[model samples]
Target: MDFDLTILGSASATPMLGRHHTAQVLAVGRKQYLIDCGESTQERLIEQKIRFSRTDCIFISHLHGDHFFGLFGLLGTLHLQGRTEPLRLFGPAGLDEVLTTQLRCSGTPLSFDVQFTCVDTTQHQQVYEDAAVTVNTLPMRHRIPCCGYLFREKPGRRRLVKDLLPTGLVPEQLQALTRGEDLRDDVGHVWLRHLDVTEPPPAPRSYAYCSDTVFTESLADLVRGVDLLYHESTFLHEMLERAVQTGHSTARQAGQLARLAGAKQLLIGHFSSRYRDLEPLLEEARREFADTNLALEGLTVGL
Candidate 1:
């Protein structure tokens, strides 16, 4: 199974000279999930060569323009492309109402159904689950109703040691071994034990996306030991007061949160436009968390 993340946009509040807004695409196996559709997100998707039809779900962290303004355009483009599959949309309350208003005003009947799920930003709960992955909401402290998302890959079956298999074993016996079940003969005699023939499954991988959130220590508990963490670093530590006032986190704080959560890798993005040079922000975060990296547009990370 392949787990990858592609950053589409990383600017905070507004688009900059070289950066767009906040948006990303997370690929879990064959399923693709869109997180935050900021302005020009469709263009970014096109640039990345990710087909729109492949994206079955879209998650909006909050109602801020920088986070979800591109959703209307993306939905409209999907209709134009003749997409008929139902698209599942998860977001905070009032999102459905706003989307409905946009559709009504434009008089564009979509070809596909938009199944909306309103997430409670104040609660930590499992919001979506499939055979390959599970998505949970991480309550965040922001100016408005907002929440981050935690994506976890499901555990796979045990692997069998081909050399240890008995001669003339049927397909059913192999399947049973993968399920951790002992194989017994038709005469009720134990042929081979599962533990001797199979190895433990690979450990599950997890990724956390925290966007436009203020410094919250409680978040560390929710995403402890995540393989990858993408936290918003909208300002440098010198501007900590402004970051707190705007419900955003500084680069150093983002690094500290990553360290506290025991994340394996940290990707810091959602940068404020005031800083033309981003090396300073990256350096600041790296000082706190040595494995921290800047989340740039068109960058893909594999887990």
Candidate 2:
């Protein structure tokens, strides 16, 4: 199975000529999960050649306009395209009410169902699960109730050594071996051991998305050992005071958190429009975490 992430927008608060707002697509196999649909996200998705109908879920970190304002337009476009599949949405408590009111005011009846799940921003808990992946909420320190999302791939079945298997083994016995179970005879005598016939599966991969949040050491514990960590870096260290005052993080802080969490790779974005050149921010983060990368529009990273 292939796991990848595509950056749609990276600007924070305001949209610029070259940069848009915050939005990303995490693709696990054929299923696509949209995170933070900021303004013009649908346009970005189209630019990336990702189908709107392929989105399996949408996750909004908070009610901030720069994070969720694009959702309304995306929903309306889906309806116009005559989509009938239900879309699962996870976000803060007031999201459902806001969405409902918007549709009502616009007099636009959706062609598909929107299944909303309110996320508790204060608790770290499992919010979604399927055969391929599991999603958990990571509490964040923001001006409003906000949370990050952690996505982890499920471990696959052990690989079978076909040449080592016995000739008379039944289908059920082979299945048991793939599941790392010992095969036994009707009399309960062990005939084959899983360890002898199978190799361990590939280790699961994990990605954590930390939206607008203040510098907090405690966040490292929640995303410890993550394969990829995408943290919002709204300003450089020179504007650290402004970052703290607005409950936003600096690029240096994002790097520090990634280093403390032992993350394999760090993606820093959600940049403030004040800086025209982003190389300085990248340099600031790389001082703490060498594997840091900038989240640019239409850039896709594989995990």
Candidate 3:
């Protein structure tokens, strides 16, 4: 029930004072997912008191060193700690080979099952799904073959209005009534009012991640109307040209993307080292979208 997203690191490739590289921890319904682990990601987890054993899957946006350098160290630590739970990784092509070769060269052996799936961003299909949620890849404009991710929880069962029911209703009858089934009496007459006994299911929740991408308008179509959105804002509007050159988005652009996508809330991070203060970034983003917030390391967004 505690669905949230915790920011671990929010810096670009370059490391700055008080800023770590890219990493995010998405705590879904009952599982934690590591998104884009950068350098010292494991250290961040320890600092936040997050158990690495809780992470069931990892989604690497791209092969950029800043986005995935800490992966080997984390894997090594997992092996050393004797992890037995199955771990899955969703990344771009050749990620399986890259990680396998790294582990092979380092002579680190894993005690658990590790599965890797290559992401083809060109297609907008369901890449990973389960009974609880379904995740899709949202490709964006970046220097490399980077793509965003969309995490959506499936709709669950409807709520039952127990107080209105009679006290003598048995558990089996209650179960049938909750399932919208009509209960028949001895004479075969309907005894339960399905409409009056049940409430509609809540809306499905969704979170979209758009990190380390340039100001690409195409992404709006994929992330539109998302419940929450985390987009990279590496620079202020003053560095618009630099942001474009480096395949990054300015704070204003990120806000615009969020607004264009009709996101309920926007989280901006991946600050440039030159920025000693983040007021300008916040100010620019607020100009476009008033619901925008900064993605601080310890900050959490409950969805």
Candidate 4:
């Protein structure tokens, strides 16, 4: 039930002031999955007290330097730290070549193996899966081939109420009830109903990530009804023309997408360096969608 997202950096295009770039950590239970290893992500992880060894999977949205510039450095640091566990990486095609070329030129071989999966930016497909969650790619319209990620938790088994259990029922019978199945007694009579003995499982929660994309209505269907959504708002409404030209979104546009997608909550970030104050962006988004928040560094949102 430990589902939350922690932001590491939230700047866009260039690093300025105290802001670095784009990176976040999604923690589901004890496992941690990294999303977009922007510059200084390794340091941020250490600063946040997140164990790098616990991170088994990484998802990179695109080949943009601000999105993945820290990956090679993190890999080399893991090598130096003597990490032995293999890491699975999902990213757009050519990422493998980029990383391999960097490693080869530097003559630094990692101690652990990096299993890479090239993602198709044009398709909405299942990219990664485990016992806890499933990740799907969300096709995005960006200046380059880019995509977002949808993280959906798996449904858990029903919870049994001990006081409601029948005395004669054994562990097997209880387990069956937990799985929403009815149990029969020796005489083939209905001994216990699943609904009578157990409570329904907790609803699965989801988080969607969208960044560096133009304002596109089709994105609404891709991330529909997520518990929480993180979308890039690199500019304000006054600069809508610039947003379109650069393949980025304005704060109002980000909120519009969240509203259209029926998201429970919207977290907006990737602010342009020109703005010293971010309240305008937040206010603009809130005007369109009341449940909106700024994606600041070190902020954690629980779902």
- RMSDs, each prediction? 1.0, 1.2, 1.8, 1.2
| lDDT tens digits, residue span 152-253, model 1 | 999988999988887887898889999999988799887789999999999999999999799999999999999999999999999999999999999999
lDDT of each candidate versus the true structure? 0.94, 0.94, 0.86, 0.93
- Using lDDT as the measure, name the better of candidate 3 and candidate 4: 4
Q: Choose 2 or 3, whichever is better by lDDT.
A: 2
Q: Hey, what RMSD does candidate 3 come out at?
A: 1.8
State the lDDT of candidate 2 residue by residue for 28-139, as single tens digits. Answer: 9888999999988989988889987988699999999999999999999999999999999999999999999999999998999999999999999999998889999999
What is the C-alpha RMSD, rounded to one decimal, of candidate 1?
1.0
Predicted structure 3: clash tally: 0
Each prediction's TM-score against the native? 0.98, 0.97, 0.94, 0.97
Most accurate candidate by TM-score:
1
lDDT tens readout by residue for model 3, 37-124: 9999999999999988988889999988988999888988998899998899998887888888997887876888788989986566
Which residue segments of model 4 deviate by more than 4 Å? none
lDDT (Cα, tens digit) per residue for candidate 4, span 233-276: 99999999999999999999999999999999999999999988
